[model samples]
Target chain A: MSEFEIIRDIFAPLTATAPGAFNLVDDAALLEQQNLVVTKDLLVAGVHFLAKDPLDLVARKLIRANLSDLAAKGAKPLGYFLGCVWPKHTDRASIEQFARGLAEDQERYRIGLYGGDTTVHSTKTGPLTLSATFLGTPPKQGMIPRSGASLGDDLYVSGTIGDAGLGLAALRKEFKFTTVDKASLSSRYHLPEPRLTLGTALAGLATAAIDVSDGLIADAGHIARACGLRAEIDAVAIPRSAGAASWVAAQENRWRALATLASFGDDYEILFAAPPAMRRSITVASKASRTEVARIGTLSRGEGVLFLDEAGRPIPVEKPGFNHFT
Target chain B: MSEFEIIRDIFAPLTATAPGAFNLVDDAALLEQQNLVVTKDLLVAGVHFLAKDPLDLVARKLIRANLSDLAAKGAKPLGYFLGCVWPKHTDRASIEQFARGLAEDQERYRIGLYGGDTTVHSTKTGPLTLSATFLGTPPKQGMIPRSGASLGDDLYVSGTIGDAGLGLAALRKEFKFTTVDKASLSSRYHLPEPRLTLGTALAGLATAAIDVSDGLIADAGHIARACGLRAEIDAVAIPRSAGAASWVAAQENRWRALATLASFGDDYEILFAAPPAMRRSITVASKASRTEVARIGTLSRGEGVLFLDEAGRPIPVEKPGFNHFT
Candidate 1:
């Protein structure tokens, strides 16, 4: 079964009593009374990232992934609880390096490490597994749920959409890249910049929002399916970093290249939907937050996500997004 | 390095700005203004439990472990966030079974499920790893910190000790056991009864508190070290279940046998410190909460913990508790 099916069939019932949990469908759980948003994310080496990646970058990625959830909910992070299952024979120096990563991010995000557990795996070859639970205070207007999107809503994405995917590809040597571009792409994969400012700024403006972690088309599909609407994206309007654009230009089939980019996960950009009338307000908020925003699509009375070409032809996508189960 | 040393040397400094984190020394981190207590724990298969343990019991144990931390802080559980890294090829039925276990405990504890992450390891040989972050409301009088114990304070522990360790032993077939005893011991190891009621009841009455997870003596040592005092325990006063008592009776060296019991972790009982004057009040609280409490030790102006015999002679203990890193 897919992750969604597992969550819907098995875990959703567990949240029956928690109205704020949004039936396990939202990006983060809401504590409505306190205007608090809570989110947890797990990352295992060899699955989420290369096992040989720097411990510092691994630590930062763990924190950023959860922060992106809170960001999507328009929440200001307060602190986080961490759980680390260190591989056996893990030296104190390696742990200190991980701590240094957390320390650097704590300073960057202005959040503290509340408390957590650290245990070493019993076997020498066990992979490093990490989990983080982040708590945040939501904007005064409250959190934006992914299911809040309305039909005829215009979708906007913060920053670039496919840079992280390109970065991963570059790291894997799937394609050649300039020294600077390779470093930049690798950094994008290793460390995500959570759109906290834009998320908070769009709080009262955006009808619904979600972070692009599970690929743009897939996450946009999440909002689309959540609100019972079809997210119709103008494929040409999908923003990409220069490196990603160049990479796409080099591909034999531009449409398939674009599809691959849209289907790749790890972009921590906020994907939001708002009524067409709110476009001006979103632009103003975007500028005020100093974040780049691109109008990518519109929510229509249909189902799932649809990527259209410049000629208004619907492009076929074999896989809409990243599914861990697959 | 020991878990305590890892926390102190590597993690504590990260909590410098979060006063409520108690420098990573306390069981649960406090959110003072919200009267909230939060804790996170990670359990890995083959390390924390046998790999073949029931999924339901594993789920319950993960929740109960975090609940125990909240209980130690005199807090009433509100909800929990979970992170499950299921072993590869995990079936729908297995996950459903795990959910059922969580469902049972959620009803028993009257706590709602918050939000969390669920992922599958990429490797078939990967051990299942689970994490939980529990949040709760502290008692009206506020939390009972581990560092609150004072000199001349009497130390108390709720419920029986050593059963969990013996239960694990029985499961491993380390010794012979009656069918009834084996089942009882196995249940104790799988399902620890968190002393929540007793902990909250001791709010204003107890000076300091900690859950007996890393053995009674080690937990007592935690409170002692936190408060710059020494704990002196009467070995004979340590309470034990009938199964544990019979096992101790069968041992040739009673002193070493008793020491083994005191050093066995996973008790999940609350160990607390209180003034001698509150002895009668404690009995009232204990009875009202329907939890058995034994005054087994006292704090003095010294360091570490000392276990004494009936003649008041200190009995040497090689290892006082379970250390994950060791």
Candidate 2:
């Protein structure tokens, strides 16, 4: 079963009568009357990142991953509770390095570590597992939900997609690139920039929003499916970094390459929906937040998603997203 | 380095200016002005519990552990975000069983599941990791802090201590017991009852409180150390279940056996301190909450903890409690 089916059929009932839970459909949950929004994400070494990856970068990546969720809902993060299980016999220096990483991000995000647990795995071979529960205050205009999109809403995304995917590919030595390109891409994978400011700015403007962690097309589909609308996107209109564009240029089938990029996960950018009439306002908000925004699609009265090429020809995507359980 | 040192020297600084974090010393953190309290706990199969345990029981253990933290702070649990990393190849039935456990507890505790991530481990051998971030509301009298214990405060514990520890021993086959005793002990290890009602009732009366997860003596030390005092316990005063008392009676060295039992972890009972003047009030509250209470010790000037015999002689304890990292 897919992750969605598991959540909907097996786990959704656990949510009971809590309306803030959103029936486990939204990226974050609201604490009614407290104006608080909360989100949690767990990462395991070798699954989410290389087991040998530097502890500091791993720490930052974990923090950013959850922050990206809050950003999607226009929540200003207050603090996070961290749950870390280090591998057995991990040295103090390594743990200190991890703390240094948390300190760096804590300063950058202006959030504190509220409280958490740290335990060393009992088995030497056990993986480094980490979980962060982030708490934030929603914008006064209120947090945006992914299911609030309307049929006529125009979809926009912050920053570029595919760079992080390419970066992962480069890290695995799947493809060779220039030193600069490789470094840039690798950095993108290691340190995703959560568009917090942009999300907060768009809270009152965007009808719906979600973070692009499970690929652009998949996340856009989330917004579409939640609102019972079809999302139509121009493949070429999906923003890309210069390196990503160069990589696509070298591929035999440009459409296929672009689709692959759109299907790759880990781009922690905001994918949001707004009315076409709010385009100018979105531009102003994006500029004010110093985040690049691109309009790539529109929601229509239908279901699922449509990926169209420059000539309006549909491109087939075998897999449109990442699902932990398939 | 011990877990406490690692937390104090490295992780504590990350708390920064968040006073609610209590410098990462408290079991739960307060969200200033929100009247909300939050706590997080992580459990890994093979470390926190046997990997072969039933999925439903494991699920309950995870939820109860976090709820135990809330109980220590005298908070009424609102809901929780659950982060689960299921083992690869896990069957749908297993996950369904896990959700069933959660459903059972949500109804029992009047709490709901909020939101969280569910991912399958990339490797088959990876441990089944789970985390729960619980949110709660403090009583009208405000939540009790572990550091609030006074020199003359009486150290009391709700429910019998060491039963869960003895239960673990029975499960491990380190000891032989009657079939009924074994089942009872094993159940205690698998499912701990969090003293929520007692904790809530004691909020206005108890000067300090903490859950007895890391053995009775170690937890008492936590309160004493936090408040810059010493805790002196009358060995005979520590409450024990019928099976535990019988087991202790069979040991060659009564003091050693008692010490061993006190050193075992996972009791899930609330260990707290209240002024001596509130003894009557505490008794009334305990009866009203339907929770048994035992005055095990007293707080005094100085540091550390003293486990004393009937004649007031201090008994030596080689190891006071369980430490995840040492």
Candidate 3:
């Protein structure tokens, strides 16, 4: 099938059942309701993923990355706009698989492929780039902004952290692992499950929220800066996956490995904060969604992120979060 | 002065003044509004533009392309999401200039820069690719869908056509031009004025509307297919710029050139159809807005687009419109 055919047959079918599916063929899609929450992300082939990675996984990754942003704001996705650039020698099968993956994710998120533009290049060295814009409805109480955290609010995380980071290390073959460890690590890297349920549930309950695209400490730092409050993370409370522990145990630079795992980007887990009084209710909601909820830290009356041991001793780092420029 | 810095300093400031400008430092900006319209466009360097094109113009072109989509639906742009891919050797100055241009267009359009992603590639063979997603609001009466046209509706165009195509020809050195001709043509190529005012006014009046991106005839064909009606255009009634007649007079392939101009894309003008009863009101509205509106065709109980001479004879062409796949 041609690229257009692939998009029409696979991706198009997935969009048929979306909320605002009527105008998919138009230049833009119209939402039925008035209020909206929108976000976008760009994924470049080499920088964001290896060219040799499975095309289906790459497509899924792209969707998940954007969905994570929506989840952070406690928004339910309505539709997505896609922009794709194809390489010269891109085969029909590859495009078909990519479309199939996109279709799968669209159905999973209940989002229509509203409208987008596609272009092809003659050069082989150019990496394919996929940009997705996610549209959704903000909660009635208003979205949980990164800047809404309050001093003395409890820090919480939905789902285990560092799996995606460790998964990346395993993918690069920089670390060796057993069969189960390999499967767990690879799954983390290839299929990041955004905490959409937790995000939507925490809309009114959480004081502040952000998806852990960067490492836990770094993402928390974003909340701190935005809220004009210092965040203190109890390092001992960070939840690590089964494989992550094994990987760290085998490392001579255990502390460094743990820190890297804590700082590595691509974990789609939601890290949020709320009043200490609301912690029990937040945990109940998280459990109802079948996602783990842990109190990892607290917001303080200061700036930046402060990491502490169980005894509340400060842990120093060069920086708290990932800087794209650096 | 890195790419991120340019985004933070230049583009961020322009978007700051608009509503829903959230944490630019986050993975995505959260937009809170009712009724969102989302559209995206991808522009590849060599494919959509020349490598040596001014950075400012490139940025403006990217924004205009997206804004034009919103204009077609009578949607007021709320914000934009940009996805940029730069070459490895690209310096901060070029990116900063591009950001400045982006800021200029954002302020002009009264839209914010919500969020986007950026990446750098190693190959010089790959042209820079910029993708923009525009979030907008539908008019109170709702968006004018391309499929809403009815039989016996009068077809209208907001502005003169074919300037951009001619501008492109001038840019490729395929045509020689006088200083005035060069300025006019280059302006058309570099900056497309989207008919936002006309589109907004057309919300309740026009049966259906679409932006004339793929030439008048081809775009008319889209309306015909969507609304299940035949659209017939009177070639003699179609408005043209002063340079159009001169260029046609100078060309040996006058008929071909005229046909080419009629099928040229990037006009960013609105093409709509309305009942005879709304004709007088539409004219009044057009006059009030100071946007030119010409009645160039009529919709009939048939399918496809028919181009006719003054005597009603059909004008034949090998291709009706430009296809992205083709």
Candidate 4:
């Protein structure tokens, strides 16, 4: 079958008249209301993930990456748009597997597969590219914009930092891990879950929030700049994985490993800020969700991001975050 | 600066509030209302267009291609999401030019730039990949779904067809064209204008509508299959450019040329069905909008698409439309 025929056969049966479902073949999809939240993310094979990565894992990662953005602002997933460039060498079975993974992820998120495009090219060297645009509803009160952080607000992260980063490092052979640690680390790299529940819970409580796609320090800098406030992170308080302490203890280059933990991307954790008064409520909600929460720093009156060591000395770093252009 | 820094500098300053914008940075963009119209399109370098295609035209095509979906449903433009993969060797100026083109096109459509991702890849041979998700508001009464066509409904197209496809053929040296024809054909290839105005106007009148991304016969076939009916089109009634007619007349291959026109994609015109009674209103609206309107066919109580010559003889053809998978 041709590309068009395949799409029609696969997607036509999946089509149904949902209340807000757009005419899928139309020029654009229509939303029911005026208040809309949209986000887009692109995943390139090799850079974003290996070409040999499991289709299921790739599908999950793509959705999680986009959902992580929604989690940062406490938005509800409405639906998504997927654009795929299928490699010429990919067989029908592989395509089916990919589609199945996509369907699974969509159901998991309760998001409709509103529309998308798929194209095939003859080029042998192009990476498989998948881009997803997620549509969500803002919080009832409003959204937690990146610009909402205020001076003196407590900075918190929904889960431990650097696990995903460390996972990548391990994947790259920068470090070796025990069998148990290897499984855990690989899971972190393959399926970093978005903290949706905690983010939604903190929507009104958190002054500002952002998903940590780049490293914690780098992403925190985004919040700081957006809100025009300085962020001061205490390195000592930065949460580590269960095995991180042991690994660091055995490492000759402890500082280097620690720094790597703070600089790696792919950590789909939500980093947010809130006033001290909201700490109790945050803790309560965190407990209710059975999710970890930690205060690693504070937003201050200055600008830019600063990391303080145990002795309160500022640590100088070459770069704060992942640079896509570089 | 690195890719990350480039994104920060280019997009950070533009960060305001896309509350309803469904931006990229958030977990998901919120849609204010329901009955959303959503669509996605992917553009791959080499396959879709040449690598050296002007950045402005590339950006315009991205928006226009997606916008065409809205036009098919008689919907209005709302916003869009962009997913881009920057070639590893791409310079800052190229990126800026691309962004500038996008900005201009977004402004033209009154569509907000909600969110998107920028990634760099190691693949050296793949053409730049770009994808866009367009969100639109369904017509007040509702969408003219492709499945809504009824027997005896009149078929119509918003504008001339086959120009873009012919342009491609011309570019490949498969055909020759006069200078005037070449310019017109190339323009059709480079910049397809989505029939937003006509689509909106036809919202109530068109019982079913679809953008003619694929050639007329193929796209019309979509309506036929969707509505579980057959389409009988009068070939002479199909619109054509002046050069197209001349070429056909000169080569005595009018049927072949017409079939090619019927099977090509990227026209971005609306092919719609309307009840016979609504003809007057549609004609008036088309006149007011200064866009040509032609009655090319009728819906029949059958399956498949059929093309008829002046004597009502069926024309033999191998394919009805461009199929993506094949």
Candidate 4 residue lDDT tens string, B1-326: 67556666664333233454422333344556556677788998877877888887898898898888888787788776677887888888887788777777777887776667777777667579998887677788787688788889999997898888888887777898998998889889999999888988888889998888777998898889878899999888889888777766776667765777777887888899999999899999798777888899999988888898889888887777766566
Candidate 3: the clashing residue pairs are A34-B34, A34-B35, A35-B33, A35-B34, A35-B35, A36-B33, B230-B302
lDDT of 2 by residue, A1-326 (tens): 22234334433443443344445432223343465677778888977888989999999999999899889988898777778887887766777677778778877888766556667778887889999988788788977777788888999999999999999999999988899999999999999999999989998999988899889988887788778899999899999898999999999999999999999999999999999999999999999999999999899989988999999888999889887766
In DockQ, how does model 1 score against the reference complex? 0.19
- For A160-258, candidate 4 gives per-residue lDDT tens digits of 777776676777787888877767877898888888788778878888898998888888988897788899998878788875666677777666656
Q: Scored by CA lDDT, what does every candidate get?
A: 0.81, 0.82, 0.80, 0.78
Model 4 chain B — which ten-residue stretch has the worst lDDT?
A: B20-29
Interface RMSD list for the candidates: 12.9, 12.8, 2.7, 2.7
Off by over 4 Å in 3: A1-10, A89-92, A307-322, B1-7, B23-33, B122-126, B276-279, B309-313
True contacts kept of 2: 0.37
Which ranges of candidate 4 are over 4 A from the true structure?
A8-19, A22-30, B8-35
Give the top-scoring candidate (TM-score): 4
Roughly what TM-score does model 4 have, to 2 decimal places?
0.94
The 10 consecutive residues of candidate 3 chain B with the worst lDDT sum are B25-34
Docking class of 4: medium
Highest lDDT against the true fold, candidate: 2
* Candidates, ranked, lDDT: 2, 1, 3, 4
Report fnat in order of the candidates: 0.35, 0.37, 0.58, 0.82
**Cα distance off (Å), candidate 3, residue A114:** 2.9
